[model samples]
Target chain A: MQESNARVGAPDWLEEIRWNADGLVPAIAQDAVTGDILMMAWMNAESLRLTAEEGQAVYWSRSRGKLWRKGETSGHQQVISEIRLDCDEDVILLKVEQKGGIACHTGRRSCFYRRLEGGQWASVDPVLRNPEAIYGKKQGGSNHE
Target chain B: MQESNARVGAPDWLEEIRWNADGLVPAIAQDAVTGDILMMAWMNAESLRLTAEEGQAVYWSRSRGKLWRKGETSGHQQVISEIRLDCDEDVILLKVEQKGGIACHTGRRSCFYRRLEGGQWASVDPVLRNPEAIYGKKQGGSNHE
Candidate 1:
């Protein structure tokens, strides 16, 4: 099936994205060359369209009720390498180029800021800076800490 | 801000995380040693519960309306070695041990499946296999392709 489909059209696996009851699918971003799982975001049709068309990783913000362009303010945008829909077409694989230091607004390279040590969740590193400082806005910066 | 709060009660950052609009925050996961991003997911109160207790990456599944263990079904569980909460305490960082060959369920090593070639979004590489083949039953496997 994959062989025949890979030849004529998009990969046969593109059909696997499972959109779920909602029109949204979970998208996982990773550093394409390094293979790091950077972050996850939601992608509806519109967000997906913008990401694919403009080659930017666009996401649907559940909190703000709109589309979000990664690094829009902080210059931490994710450059699109590819966008793969899962077998069910519900999830997406966003290969991105996150510029600057951290893709997360909170001043960390990534958003996860907890580590498990001796069975306890512990803070491993300090935040680099406030998102507002870099982004120059309150809500536009997603981090509150 | 960080010093005064550390002397007494909950750090100001921790307080900030508790009050997030959606009662949840973004968490980032990276390879502990290699620093490769494994994946990103959402964490609410309950999602945090499972992640801390289980020592792996857990996420809130909006579609399922429940908590999801990253690799319980797929054997790709992210074993966290360290965690950090940003100053706003809203974002989290996880240094984890990614189980299995790839962290992504879509058969890529990670979720960023597409790469930009020239100016078009392209499938960067062949999927390792149908997710069904590796994860086996229960995850809605799709090795059929």
Candidate 2:
């Protein structure tokens, strides 16, 4: 999806994105230094633009139906190092320095802490902090929403 | 999202997925051998169920509004080695053996071949085969839609 960078408005690169019918694209957050996939979230055009401009992670919450700035509540922000889009222009990948060394609301290093084994998913990673302590009680279910 | 596997109808784990308003979840396909993310696609409950049962990659095509069987045309099927659900239960990950060594319709090993550089996306991965050779003319845009 590369082209000359002289185009106006949203730039030709952003326009090349094949946004879903809902105007959303899947964005993956990977740890820049460790290359470990921290989490996967959705982003709309506005959130993507904001993320690029803000140099941090911003995602579209499908359930909440709004923009979600990473670390807005839990103090686990992701500092963007680089952003890359897949060849089809349908997926966005971010290389970020995960703050607090935790990416999952469950207090784990990554959202992908479980692995499939023998037709069952087993949690292989330990929770660095308790969710109750990280998000408090009222915000415990914030990540899922 | 794990639970005892005795529930009837859909499993309890599957029910835990907080599907979007459109009843979809973003699924990421990663190369089982290299750990390289090959592509990202959407999956509905049926597609996810089928992928788990069939042990292959199946995705929901938003443009076409139907289930897509990977490598149905290009012989680049992903033989799933493992399936994982993110902690939020909104994202899926598949570890697969990408057949034909090509995951992108553009004949690249992964769809994430472009790297953002200097405000521009530069293709850093070489195409192993030509798109014309992989899918012929009629199926050239099969991967996109």
Candidate 3:
């Protein structure tokens, strides 16, 4: 009784544990100061554990089938300030401190750069941080057409 | 009549503009398949057009005061397939085809790689791409501490 009571006053993030049929849950990341979303990813028990263990944001790569550590190389680390779970326990909202410019590797501050309009998509923002500057690529090699 | 009809049939993304005090809207990007949120950014009417016009994600960089294009240099491009707007018109959602392994400059598949537990942060994933390969000295100078 004493042991459980000692651990009782924890944050809501610690109690969140609703998993999908595939044993996964959706985790959403946002900028704590700006209220801007930085990115989203999945987490299982182990992946969730890894994120809490490290202050840097971490996620499960569904395609790569591995754990992904944020800022390991790029230096755009997310220092978490808070984590919240929705009522259903299936969704998580992370409030974090971003260390560098542009959360998206695509060179945009955010991943949502395309707009759906008139049955056509459009590019509204100019390309910042020349991809060559960020990725050292010839700017036409691997990105999808 | 032509302009009016053209506007009516246009995709919701274009027809509706979420004008804030500064004539901008908030855009949120989420994983198309996994429903994991990747990041958030801002756009004006013009910025939104650049994303659709280029077929790549773009955003207005408030910090840099420029229109930023995603993946123009980095291989990690987000090909937008669809865009959704909430009822408030102040927020937007982007559905994207992310390639080259990440949405984050930090090399995480998604920018968010941390989870909160018991009032402490946890690491939930591993590093996907080599940050040195993606960012070089720019991101390499940061400290893990």
Candidate 4:
């Protein structure tokens, strides 16, 4: 199956990713144009492959031990423009055009909404929408976290 | 000691970070001014504390099972300007001034220097210095991967 994927235009470079002991690599999603980091998630080999093939963000949910397509429940899918690997091949970066202008489970543009200020973490960014409105009552919690 | 730190104005928010089952959290280092993500590393409680106290990047070396002070070897220290936690508290973001203008041990401005292109991982950025020059004969390989 892996060989068939490579034959079907899947890049062999995926095999070069140096996954950690747990078979996971840290993947960061960044706004393609603004460079604002949207979020970070773990990606296993299968998730990375599917993400590349699907041109969307797919992450490995360690807590659930399953594949998770970003914004699957929130309708804020990330449209990947480019994928990058760190020099050490352990980290992945996705340049994405975020749909719905929301990326955080909190319904914020980015998960990184709080900033450290005066020895305190202050929520400096506004919540774009209440998460309850986005995910409904099933807004149990974030799988990526 | 922990109490003394709190008395000295250390915010208790650090304790709120939701580490993974492995007691590690993903931390992304971004160029404070440019907003370019320089690298990603893991941090444990101790490393996170030390980084906050020292105003530099400190990481937990999963492979070595020891704390690593960034730039301790390559003189490419990440002087942190601010540290932010994601809403979910599972990730950290550091706004840093990358010392020496190099963040990657491979002598690149950022560890994320390679981009996916034409079914291959292409090195799209220039190396500012050779790894040999940065770490001498001990350019032993990146601890990141």
Name the candidate that leads on DockQ: 4
Weakest lDDT window of 10 consecutive positions for candidate 2 chain B = B1-10
lDDT of 4 by residue, A12-77 (tens): 888788877777888999999999999988888888888888999998887787888998988889
Q: Tens-digit lDDT track for model 2 on B40-69?
A: 888888778788889899888877888899
Residue lDDT tens for model 2, A1-145: 1112212367556777778777877899988887678899888877887788899999888778888999988899999998889977888999899999998999999898777665566898999998888888876454634
- The single-chain TM-score for chain B of candidate 4 is 0.90
Question: Which tens-of-lDDT digit does each residue in B1-145 have in candidate 1?
Answer: 1223232454333444542455556666667888755455567765665576677888766456566778766777788776666444555667788887577777776554454444344666567767778776567533111
Interface RMSD of each: 6.6, 2.1, 12.2, 1.3
Candidate order (DockQ)? 4, 2, 1, 3
Model 3: DockQ vs. true structure: 0.09
- Which 10 residues in a row give candidate 1 chain A its minimum summed lDDT? A1-10
Which candidate gets the maximum lDDT versus the true structure?
Answer: 4
TM-score of 2: 0.84
- Top candidate when judged by TM-score against the true structure: 4
lDDT of model 4 at position A101: 90
Q: Write the per-residue lDDT of candidate 4 for residues B1-145, one digit (tens) a residue.
A: 1223333543587777777767788899999999899999888877888888899999988777788999988888899898989978989999999999999888899989999987789999999998889899766867463
lDDT of each residue in B124-145, candidate 3, tens digit only:
7667887778767566321110
TM-score of each: 0.57, 0.84, 0.48, 0.89
Between the candidate structures 1 and 4, which one is better when assessed by lDDT? 4
How should the candidates be ordered by lDDT, best one leading? 4, 2, 1, 3
What CAPRI class is candidate 4? medium
